[model samples]
Target: MSSAPSIPSAPSTHPAPPAGWQATFSEAVRLQSENRWEQALTLLLPLAEQMPHEASVQNLTAVLLAQHGRLAEAVVLWQRLLAADPGNVALVANLGRACWMLERKQQALEYFSLAVQLQPQDPLALLNMGAIHQGEGRFEEALAWYERVFAVDPHHVQALFNSAQLHADAGRFTRAHELYRRVLAIDSKHVIAQAQLIFTQHYLEHPSPAQLSALARRLGAQCAAQSPVFSNWLVSFEPERPLRIGLLSADLHDHPVGYFIEGLLAHSAGKEVTWIAYANNEKRTALTERIAPAFSAWNEVFRWSDDQLAARIRSDRIDILLDLSGMGSGHRLGVLARRPAPVQVNWLGYFGTTGLPGVQAVIADPRCVPEPEEHWFSERVWRLPSTRYCFTPPKNAPEVAELPALRQGALTFGCFQTLAKINPRVIAAWARIAQRAPQARWRIRCGVKSSEEDRRSLAQRLVQAGIAADRFKVEAPLERQRYLASYGEIDVALDTFPYPGGTTSAEALWMGVPTLTLSTPGMLGRQGEQIMGAAGMAENWICFDEDAYVDRAVALAQRSAWLALAEQRRAMREQVAGSALFDNARFSRDWHELVRNIWRDACEQVISRSSQGISGPKP
Candidate 1:
């Protein structure tokens, strides 16, 4: 939906109008302020028709029309009003915002430029201009506007948030953290700020696990206090019957979560579980269309308020709610805080603890989150037998070509993880690996499309680490087919340490390349270990420390025939296709048993509490 145009800052300076026009305008303005849209339109429509040349009447009518999704009509009205008074800063900004929302990018920029020229100090004009630049992927230019806004209004939350987001995207975590803290200091309850603050911590060089857990707990408490409670609804649990499982995620369509979830959904096709998926994705895709038929019920609840979503879950009487998005995008932590479902589980889409007390457990394997490290999580750990995820590669992937490094004399060690994962320490480790492995050139794909600045920064880091600039290539992102095929060029894949790649590792394994990972104590750092274990490649590849990590990569490269066989790709496919990583049926059975056990335990707790005449969260 299009937002209503902002009210013009400059009032009309025309001579005194005819009879009672001022009273009608005042009543109209009062109605609009109260959000009585129809009544406001009723009052303003005739006035606009009577005085077509009046700037206020035209601007007000355009705003009302824009609010109702009449963008074309509103744009025309704005143009007419601007012709009369082109100096109105708010009017120009509103016009620019509407055009931007309508996807008229160039026109929006022109209007925003005019607005900024008219009133350089206007925060709205600066913000709107920044948004236009950001939309076009000119982040540096966008930062200039946000900085200007901050200079004028130190407490402007939006300006701070946008600037922080840009910094985070560019992998400047420290600056992002500082700005996020500033936002929280101004408005502690800001949802995005709270969530992103927790997210940026993992990027720090030596993030404290205790500090992360504490932050989660604090955010959970805030959410619990703010959202409505559903303590009375716990009595709705029924243990004797089959469970109605509700899976929640925004990435239920063509994402890593979606690929892993397909196997479970397919394998559980005849199970007794009643599947209900609450999708938080704003727009539907072809992938969503394909996956929709598998679920007993699918709800597109992206627009639903937290209270409304919680009420819906309660009304559905869902026995167990599994959230795939732990701290990532499209998460409804507030809804989970209400405890609408009897049992809540945190699964994929995040690495660290959710810090939510309402979440009862997290699904994992012993390799991912060892017993000693369980204190890092707020939820109980439910370990699976082999792997936490059963990955299904895209059906359209091209046939894996012969390893390019094998045919050529030199080895190509590649990693397709994001720029954020490739920190200075990781680069130094890769440099050591390069020194040990003779004629091995590093090729790192910045998983997303990158700017020249991003590529240059990464290249500079590699150069500073005593590696020749020409020895490594920092390539921009590739299209999907080409991305999968590029793995063919690599002899071995090197995983990022501390915060390793999850889906990228899986994809590398699927494309017939072996990924070497360094496993740390934290759960966020051990996903590659679990993923490699699932593929039956962890025995020699998972490293304990930096030396071992470098040694493993050197070992893989030094061993001839490691990437030689033309049939190597086919053989790797057979191994993975039959292994636990891609075994859908096995994963489905494990998931079913786990859900039943958790549900049974929850029901038993409810029964015991009732008999003892006590009521609280399920034990």
Candidate 2:
């Protein structure tokens, strides 16, 4: 993402201070050390006026203000300090941090560069610089900066975590695994790192399905032991009554999760369920605005602590709480572990096991998780009958255009997933596909607009594999409507392996562009395959290996009746629009039944335990 638009500079406007500044400054420092930020700021504000020209005083005051969310004021003070002490590394670095907090990324990068130049070994400077490059889609540069930080401080957790993420993003699973191991060795209790290590295994050829189940059982046992259990009397699920349901997630805005959920919400409204949304995103978008009213109640709990959120859930007396975000950041796994509701399940927003004992099930579809694979989860594998997702196509999508190859004389194969999913192996596979269809051009649309550097780098890699530079096209990120329209430019969509496109595939199909996906043994790689299969296009698009993939693409490109098939795709939309894949009402009703059954089963267990004279500890 680019830097945010510039904001007007904050003016220096502090009044002159009283005397005896030294004693007050010391008191402020003491309060700051004690973590009493408001009290510290009260002392430091007045002291700043007495010593406006002193760098130390101004730095400390600015730090306090920044810590207290007074970013504009802190930026003013930090800039004033930097103007006087241009060579001071701390002042320069702090100014950069304040600017970054204000989303003034251009200014932040400049100051951070100055700080790094002043002290090459500074870890904070290195980390911030790496972050800036990473945000700009400059992966190699980000990796170099992270490596430098690792060299300076080998045990730097953020550096290790971020480096591992980059590797994972680039489809270097083995290297990513090694880095995550290093992180776990240093801090075993780091929950995100632990979760990531397990998640990344899905990309490997032989992901041990049992590993997630074992991790779940172990984590669940720990949660059960340390946290007080609710007495049977405290938990209730009335099978014949309207259930109070709570959904928790950070992706309830304009995202894939939102599209998948909109249908369910519309179907569930005023039904036998009273749904509440505990949203973790602070910002709202057009989609969020559209979906917000579907919930009977909406709570913006982005600022609430896990404990606070959990207590709120219990207070609401929610019968069931479905975690839309499983191991994702901002997840309230802590709250789930505390057992705020009688039933909790992991759904939509995440794949794989959450490893939380309080979570009773992971919702899936019969096609995605076979009955034999049920043992892969710690929670019960509850399969929805048709498909897990009920896709809602974007409202502003342009009408499907005729096959581009009909006019252009050569077929164009493309994918619009994030560039991170395009690893060396994926690139090599695409090279082979292009080799098979010599006349076909390759198109890639990344999440970020492709820079010239990105195009050059990609061209270098493809040319090395015998693909011509002129045969490749890299489109920049576009607005939603135009992006959907851009799909009309390609004859076929190529799915990324191990981390294949989920929403992108849906959009492609909606635009009458069939996606060719290479299915792996693991769940992550099978999403596109499942979506296409549910849409009844498995034979036309799903492949089992590189040869099959190349064969499919080449066959499609060479067909004399290619345009007939392409024109027939216009009907493909009509086929899926009301089918199981796009039927929200059916999916919603199925989900409702699934949840009710789980809750009733839990209630039955509790009743059975009570009859057997069993009692658990009370919270």
Query: For this target, which candidate reaches the highest lDDT against the unseen true structure?
Result: 1
For model 1 the local lDDT of residue 410 reads: 77
Q: For each candidate, what TM-score against the reference?
A: 0.85, 0.80
Q: CA lDDT of 385 in candidate 1? A: 89
* Model 2 quality (TM-score): 0.80
Cα-based lDDT at residue 57, candidate 1: 83
Clash-forming residue pairs, model 1 = none
Off by over 4 Å in 1: 1-118, 559-570, 615-619
Which digits, one per residue and each the tens of the lDDT, describe model 1 over residues 402-501?
7776567777889898888888889888878777775788888986646779889989988888889878899999877888988888877898878888
Tens-place lDDT per residue, model 2, 300-353, is 876555556777788888888889877665566667777888788898887777
Off by over 4 Å in 2: 1-99, 106-122, 136-141, 204-235, 296-304, 329-332, 424-432, 449-456, 545-547, 616-619
Give the least accurate 10-residue stretch of model 2, judged by summed lDDT.
1-10
